[model samples]
Target: MSSVDICEKHRQQSTKTSFISFAFPYSHLRPCAHRCKQYVVGRSYLLQLQPKNRRNSHFSYSCEACQTEARSTSTENNISTHALSFTERLWKTYTNTATLLTNLFPLWTLLVAVLALRRPTTFTWLSTPYFTFTLSILMLSMGITLSPRDFKRIWKRPGIVILQFCSCYFLVPFLAYVLGRLFKLPSDILAGLVLVGSVNGGQASNLCTYIAKGNVALSVIMTTATTLGAIVMTPLLSKFVLGTVVQVDALGIAWSTIQVVLIPIALGMALNRYFKSFVDIILPISPVVGVIATCLVVGSAVAQCNKLILSAGISLQIPIFLLHLIGGICGYFLPYLLGYNEVVCRTVAIETAMKSSAFGFVLACLHFTAYRVRVPCAISVVWMSLVGSGLAVFWRYKPVQNLKGFRSDLAQRLRQKRQLDEMK
Candidate 1:
């Protein structure tokens, strides 16, 4: 045990005649508040003396660990008086900047979209390969943030997960299809809109949920579930929705989804499970990296679709905007109508609206080469980002409460004001 415990045990075992002695260094005493205080004079035989009982003979004991602890504490106190190293200060600054950018994800998306539109050629360099790498990194970042606790949440609240999947996969895709037909969009635009809806939940939705103070664990689980399901669902749903208009390579898109979404996320989860320490170091800056990667992906897609956007004008942008707007509103209200909490409503809304625009863009580019399928996905990256982030910011500032509660709170405030006026 410890030195104190050892001394106490010795005292418990000793007779009245027995005594214990401890010898401590002079230099360690001044710096260590917990250690002995008495000092010896003029090179005395002992530094300090404490005896439980008087005896002719006594034994001395010293604890190396206690001495080492005292010396280390003194060193730490001394070091606190000095300035931090350049590298340490630099890391602190870097983390602060990264955290700030990470929190303002929507702003980053908007900036990237505007920049991409203004200078398409500048961001055209972020090609297909770079897009995949960026998305893979983003998914990896998401995976590292997950834990067993997140998975255990499934059993705890299976209904929320089920409702989210229904909203994300079924309700959203149906709305997209209906909107495409209602708008009487062209074949290419219709296909693009449907494909966007058929894809997995947005990469940034979980982050937005966290920012909004919603159910982050639920968000993560829903994203992961939807992403994993996308391998089968995305291609099948796209084919079902777009088959009559154009020939869709469902198999090709499925394999792409596997490569783009499933594998990277799985790899990330594994790393988090097996290599947590490495993941811990990477976690601090991973969100910013993901956001930067998202900006590049969205920007590059927008750049590539610049001509299409300018020529199509509102015809293309309107459908994409409507799709996300409808998705976000329906996702929230549907869950709320079902009597779920405000947190679940917010989480589902974000999840439903924020489809994987990058994944859709990649699929459109790879499968529907002749058409401007990527245009809708690119536009969606900007639109849904603005919508989702705006909603999140609103929820962040406004506390979610029912109308009855609000009315009650307002009445209470009015009563308090009346009391204060009477007192005055």
Candidate 2:
């Protein structure tokens, strides 16, 4: 099909009969320009390049025969080379369609929340049991996506993880407390806001990080760290902040956190490690499943608080919106100020801005249901998704430039010291 094959065939025909005639078209001309007399095929030459130093610069010529043979062999390795069975092909199609749907989660969440506000009855049915199940699926999706290498990234960069952990557990919660008080939100709503901040980074953080072209592995690791830490941190912090307002059950909160976040994720990771083949089949649809679960969770919470939302003034919305807005702004700035790379900064920003609202809702339902606290958690979910998605889209186009700062300076100094020590 290629010039190489054509010339090879022509050379073989000539060897069996006579020389290649000049009347033959240029398309079938031999690669070796020097082999015109009797058209005896020249030995395959070494690779030739015009400007060898510049990879982008074109001009490569080769006729090793090995190259052609290697390419043909690689073709067989491609899926297209083999006959796929009907089910195999059908499954591939389903996964592909699911993946396409998954990318529309932001739009889908916004739409479902709006719908739930109108018809509470429709979504309210996805109640307590559904909430737990959906949240588990969301976390499970995150779990299966991960590998041991993802956890290794945590150890590879513990400092960044620490910063993220502190930001998630400390900075955001403090901001929520201050914002709630500053806005003079209702006591129950204040408790809800605090609960929102106190919980771990949402599974959605990983998706947002990926959209922003951030360090996804680092995001996943930070997510895992924050989530595991949340079991202890969330209950204690929520109690500390809301003790005066309500009876905070620290142990119940801790157990619920373990049930919702820890167990499902651990089970997912175990499946990934031990049963990779099964994981692979389901991996494509994992995000889609998470998105569906998230939408259902969002819809249910919004539906439950439908009357509250309809009657509630702008006073209720401002603090929750501001919570994510300010958290996202500061989340990005803190890491950038510390001179972390743009990707890491983006990852931390998303993780800080987006708390596990579904998890928060479940907790509020379990413990603070009497206080009508879950309403704020529902509201927080909608707002944070919008805020984080907006940031991801905005930063996708905006490039980070000349990021010279403390981190870079520190690296430089370390390199210099190492060089001096070597010289000595």
Tell me the TM-score of each prediction against the true structure.
0.77, 0.76
Q: What does the lDDT read for residue 364 in candidate 2?
A: 89
Residue-level lDDT of model 2, residues 278-387, one tens digit each, is 99988887878888889999999999988888788578888999899899888888988788767777888998999888889899898775647888898888998999
Q: Report the C-alpha lDDT of model 1 over 333-410, residue by residue, as the tens digit.
A: 876776666777888888888888888899998888546667788888899888888788888998876433334556
Per the 3 Å backbone cut-off, how many clashing residue pairs does candidate 1 have? 0
Lowest summed lDDT across 10 adjacent residues in model 1 is found at 38-47
lDDT of each: 0.77, 0.79
Pick the lDDT winner.
Answer: 2
Question: Candidate 1's error at 153, in angstroms?
Answer: 2.2
Pairing residues by index, what is the TM-score of model 1?
0.77
